[model samples]
Target: MKLYIAEKPSLGRAIAAALPQPQKNQKTHIELANGDVVSWCIGHILAQADPEDYDAELKKWRMENLPIVPEQWQLKPITRTRAQLTVLRKLVKQADEIIHAGDPDREGQLLVDEVIDYFKLSKTKKNNIKRLLISDLNLPAVKRALSSLKANSDFMPLSISALARSRADWLYGINLTRAYTLQGQKTGYHSVLSVGRVQTPLLGLVVRREQEIAAFVSKPYYQVQAHIALTSAEKVAFTAKWQPSENCLPYCDEEGRVLVKALAENVVQRIANQPALVSHIDSTEKQQAAPLPFNLSQLQISAAKQFSMNAKLVLDVCQALYEKHKLITYPRSDCRYLPKEQLKQAKGIINTLANSSLPCNKPAQGADTSLVSKAWNDKQITAHHAIIPTEKSPENSSLNTFEKNIYLLIVRQYLLQFYPAYIYQQTKVHLLIAGGQFLSQAKMEKQLGWQVLFPKSKKAKTVNNSNQKQHESEQEKTLPPLTKGQTLHCQQGELIAKQTSPPQSFTDASLLAAMTGISRYVSDPAIKKVLKETDGLGTDATRAGIIDLLFKRDFLQRQGKAITATEVGVALINALPEMATLPDMTAQWEATLTAISEKKANYLSFMQPLTAIVTEMVQGASQQSFSGLPQVAFKPKRRKKTFTKKVARKTG
Candidate 1:
């Protein structure tokens, strides 16, 4: 009998439904018409054993047992999942063939592979294990995956990569945590001092940003503004900003803001009540494509901004939509581009939305399907495409408020692909007044196009905040048709003083972007280039959890949406060595891990460097001093005194 083991029940049901006439059995397993059995795992049935599991003596924190590297890693069944493991063990023992149908990511591969390894190592080795890789959990996707089952051995490299990551994290977290805690104890401080591969580096980002903000000193700047009355056929007035002159370069910075108050006042006096000439008038038409679909990080950023939701909450919502409602494709995708082949299914998916309960009306429905942006390139697609709606129409689906909002966001992006580019005409006028040059600008919308879909949200997913500022600045009061050498009267001029502000604290939106593209924060050019080749800090699936873990450990605190490192967090960072806090370590590890996943490198090749790094860290930590850390009142339990004091009491 053939047995299919899925990562979760929702996926198992989807796969079973794709088969012909699958029936529900007594133990909740699905019996296929072809006499196959389908079972599911909640996630991981078995996990890496904790330190105490290896040796009871290791339970007590000690400096001598600093680097707790496990010679032979062991696995134990999770308490709540043991019953499910027993069922799977029985099914695995009887099956002639086993099919592994986990999620199509590194963690997913490990989840199923570990369960099989548990029984295989203890019992008999089987050569009949097959693997199914599916990006979506819908029926058609399931059927497509089932038709091309690969030998389980083919994905052993991914499993190895996942195992290496787990073991490496275990070694680093276990050893460093104990080393720090024991050191802290000597200084009369007692806190867990929890640390991890990704969480520590992430906390370092927050601490550094906070330090930068705290050390920043604001400086005053000035700009001269002019209100000019156009000498046109009709009465017209507009505002213009004074431009930098040759002598003003020392007192002025980019964006034409002058640092000297006297210079700005002089410019205003010179330009005030003077006749102005239109030295140049330029207008250029531009086109902007709609936003690309959401990868997990982008979606998390948007959700955080629009709904004030955290990254983990956004991931949960997207997961529900994908696994339970079957409304969207996979949620843990890193690619923001879709496969070219998926363009064929775009019409059907859109047609369903057009006819479904979504608020899309005639104009959105009339979007032209022939002109999707270059985001349809197949080569850009990673393990999965961007999150988009499945063919399953959510007409009567029971969706909560959060789900509906996120679903609408996805649908809006998908509909935008079919719409024409947003078109506008940008106008800039350069005016010469007295002794200074002034400039005015305006943007006239030629067509709303795809902008109509996300009427209030961002037009492009990857457009940075700097680009957004430029787009906002391009839009101003409509400029009257003017030609070169046209004369205008300066109605008024004033010196507006402003202060240069420090960088703002990170919200979830900015933090997620930074984590996704962390190379921006690194100072080393070689490491920056290396980090860019490998996507930033942590995988999309793991970054949210890393951030969440920091909060749980009191390493970070949130006020409204702004995140800041706690006192303990900053001190903890100072307590550790540079190797523990720098992004280069994780970045290099990720690059090597990628090589391992692609079969370019083996586990030993990848681990040798990490082993050295860990050893160096342990050696350095032994000599490091920690003091005045946030104190924890740790009172060791008093042992019972079993001396014979009874005889003394009787004599008294």
Candidate 2:
């Protein structure tokens, strides 16, 4: 019999619907008319065995067993899914042919492959296994995937890469968590001080920001603004900012902020009531394209900023839209670019959106189908394309308020690809007043274009450097027509005193943004380049979960939308080594994983060094003292035990 193994029950049902008719659905497997059967796994049926599984002596946490490296890694069936696994074992033995159906990403590949490995099929049956990759659960998309199947062996490297990642995480997380928790106990802190490859670095980001804010010293700075009246028919008046000359470097701060009030006063005294000559006028038209469609990270950031929704909520809403409602494509996609071939579906999807009762219906109807934005590029496609709306209309779907908001966000971003670029004219006027330089700038919108679809309140606000705040204010004012050599009277010179502000606390939106663009946080150019290439510290699928895990562990706390590290979190970071708290090591590991996926690097080369690093870290942690950490009473919860009485069976 031919067998098809799917990643989940919904996927299994979808696959069955696309097959021949006269299908019989059973609890564990579906039987087709032609002696073919379809089965599935519930996420991952198998999990990595614990350290104690290797040896009984390692059951208790001790510094002597610092780094537990298994010579032969083992897999144990998850208790919750063992029944389904039993059914699969029966089916695998009876099947003459097998098809491996899993999600296209690394985790999905590894989960299904792990089950296949557990069964230990013959070499020929393993070689004969086919692989089915499905990103969209829509009927048409599923049917297309069924027509073309690739050899499962072709994806072995992907499976291996995932295996390497899981093993590395286990080795690193388990060893460090045990080592640190034991050490923390030495100082009367009974909490389980967990450490992870990604979560620790993420917690470090928050803790370091808190430290920086605590250590900040506010200093006063001086600024000079020029109020000038134009010599035109309208007599338009505008504010211009003082531009200090190179000779004033001694009196200025590193960011060019005037530190000496006396020097700023001299400029204010010289420029007042003087005739200012327009030395330079620059006017240039600029066009800004609409932002690319939503990747998981970008979508989370947007939802968090606009609706104050947390990252986990956004991900849950997206999953519902994709799997349950069938209104959108894959939600865990990291790619923001769509395949060129998929662009042909734009008209159908747009029409569906226009006909629906969504908030963006009008804009969807007005979208130009002929105009294709730069988002459609095949070369940029990753494991999956950008999250976009399917041809399915959402009007019939019973969506909740959160689902509707997230769905509309995805649809609007996709529709933006068919809109015109936002056009604006930038005007800059350089004035010379009493031997001092003053500059005025303005931005005039020539065309709103795609910008009209987004409300100004929903737009992301840019935070300017403290030194450039005055200059930014000038750019917001309107400017009149002016030419070189034209003379205008400066009404007055104003000297404003301002104090530098400390960095703002991290909000959900800003924290997710930091994770997505972590390269900006690092100082080393080499590490920054690696991080940029690897797309930061965590995958799009796992970032939300990692952040959520921190909160559940009481390592992070949220105060009205702002996320801050808890005392336990800060103490843990203080106790850990510098390398464990930074993102540089995690970024390098990601690059190596990518190389392994591409078959350019092997698993041993990556694991050996990781093992060595873990060994050194465990050794160092053993010698470290946690006496300085804050003492918090933590009682670990004990699982309730259930006892069942056994009935003796009668011998017949």
Task: Give per-model CA RMSD.
Answer: 7.3, 5.4
Give the alpha carbon lDDT tens digit for every residue of 1-652 in model 2: 9899998998899899999989999988899999999999998888777666788787677889878999998888878889999999999999999999988788888888999999999999999999898877889888888998989998998899889888888888888877887888888987677788888999999999999999999989999998898743424399888988999988888888998999999889888778899999999988888889999999999899789999999999998998899888888888899988787788999998998877888999889999989999999885678999998888889999999999999988999999998877778999999998998887777777887788753322322233355435544678877779999998778999999889888998889988888997888998897788777878788889889888987889998877999988898888898989998888788889878987989999899999999999998886776876788776552210000000000000
Candidate 1, 1-652: lDDT as tens digits: 8999999888888888888784765454788877889998988778667676788887666777767777888888978789999999998888888899888778788889989888873333455688887777778767878998988878888889888887777677767766776676777766567666778888888888899999999889998889888643434377888888888888877765689899888877777678999999889998877778888898888888889889999999999999888999988887789888788787878788878766864544786888868679888764568888888878878999899988887777777788888888888899999968899988888887877765544543323366776556655366777889889888778889899998899899999989888999889999998888786888888888788878877889998889999988998888888778877788778778878988988898867777777777877776766774777787442210100111111100
**What TM-score quantifies how close candidate 2 is to the native fold?**
0.94
Question: Where is the poorest 10-residue window by lDDT in model 1?
Answer: 643-652
On lDDT, the candidate that comes out on top is: 2
Residue 25's lDDT within candidate 2 is 97
- Assess every candidate by TM-score: 0.89, 0.94
